[model samples]
Target: MRTILQRVQHASVTVEGEISGKINHGILALVGFEPEDTNEDFEWITKKIIQLRIFNDENHVMNLDIQQTEGEILVVSQFTLHAATKKGNRPSYIKASKPDLANEQYEKFLQILENNFKAVQKGIFGADMKVELLNDGPVTIFIDSKNKE
Candidate 1:
């Protein structure tokens, strides 16, 4: 499992000119998965994302998590996160799970988030989505369950 988290003042996703999901003062998570990604990975990544101290505190230090700030989360399926670019000019998605599998994973991931957190929004699993976000601090963090970095 892999995810790119962007701290945003607000974010929204549109599909076919219709707003699907939106959030305020939280994180925009672009998520992907591999064929081998397991429930364990989902559980681990969920904990990491929610517990991350990326938001600022009263002293202006990045010491608060999303829950502490009472923020929401906007999650989008992003198979491209696993694009392998070592070969040719075109990127290969060989590392990404097939749509059937990834869609299942995506749903499971969303369920986990909804169960564990508050105010969660999401984009369609396999739709063409346009995402708009005002990046707060332009803070972006990439997390990979396999690498654990």
Candidate 2:
């Protein structure tokens, strides 16, 4: 599994002129699943996300986690995050999990995240979506389950 986490002041997902999910003062996560991803991967990322101390504290230092700030979450499925572009101009999504498997993992990830968050929003999996967000601090992080320092 791979994830791109961005701190946002506001975010929303719309499909067919209808707002499906939205949030304010939270993190927007773009998640991707691989064939080798398992429950452990989901657990690890979910814990890290919720515990991440990127929010400001009383002193305006980035010392508070999402829970401390009572922030929400917006998780969007993005298999394209696994695209491999090492060869040629065309990127290959061969590393991205198949839709069936990816969708299953995606839902599992969302469930785990919501279990620990105040509010969680999600984009429709495999659907064309228009995502809008006001990135707060423009703070972003990329995490890969297989990469451990």
Candidate 3:
């Protein structure tokens, strides 16, 4: 599993001109699953995301986790995160999980977030989505479950 986590003042996802998921003062997570991802990957990545201390505190230090700040989370499935671009200009998604399996894992990931945190939101899997956000601090972090980095 791979995720691009961004701290946002507000974020929203639209599908066919209708808002599907939205959040305020939270993290916008673009998640992707690889063929090798497992339940362990799901557990570790979700836990890390919720516990990440990217939000600032009273002293202007990045010391607050989402749970501490009562922030929201908007998760979106993005298989393109696993795109392979080494060989050519056009990317290849062979490393990404197949749609059936990816959808299942994506839902399970959302469920985990919902259970562990408050104000969890998500975009529809496999949908054509338009996402908008005001990036707080312009802070963005990339995480990969397999690498543990």
lDDT of 1 by residue, 8-32 (tens): 9999999999999999899999999
Global lDDT scores for all candidate models? 0.96, 0.92, 0.93
Clashes of each: 0, 0, 0
Worst 10 residues of 2 by lDDT: 110-119
Candidate 3 error regions (>4 Å): none
Order of quality (lDDT): 1, 3, 2
Inter-residue clash pairs, candidate 2: none
Best-matching candidate per TM-score? 1
What are the per-residue Cα lDDT tens digits for candidate 3 across 8-47? 9999999999999999999999999987887889889989
TM-score of each: 0.98, 0.97, 0.98
Question: lDDT by residue for model 2 over 9-52, one digit each (tens)?
Answer: 99999999999899999999999999999989999999989999
Model 1 segments beyond 4 Å from truth? Answer: none
Measured by lDDT, the strongest candidate is 1
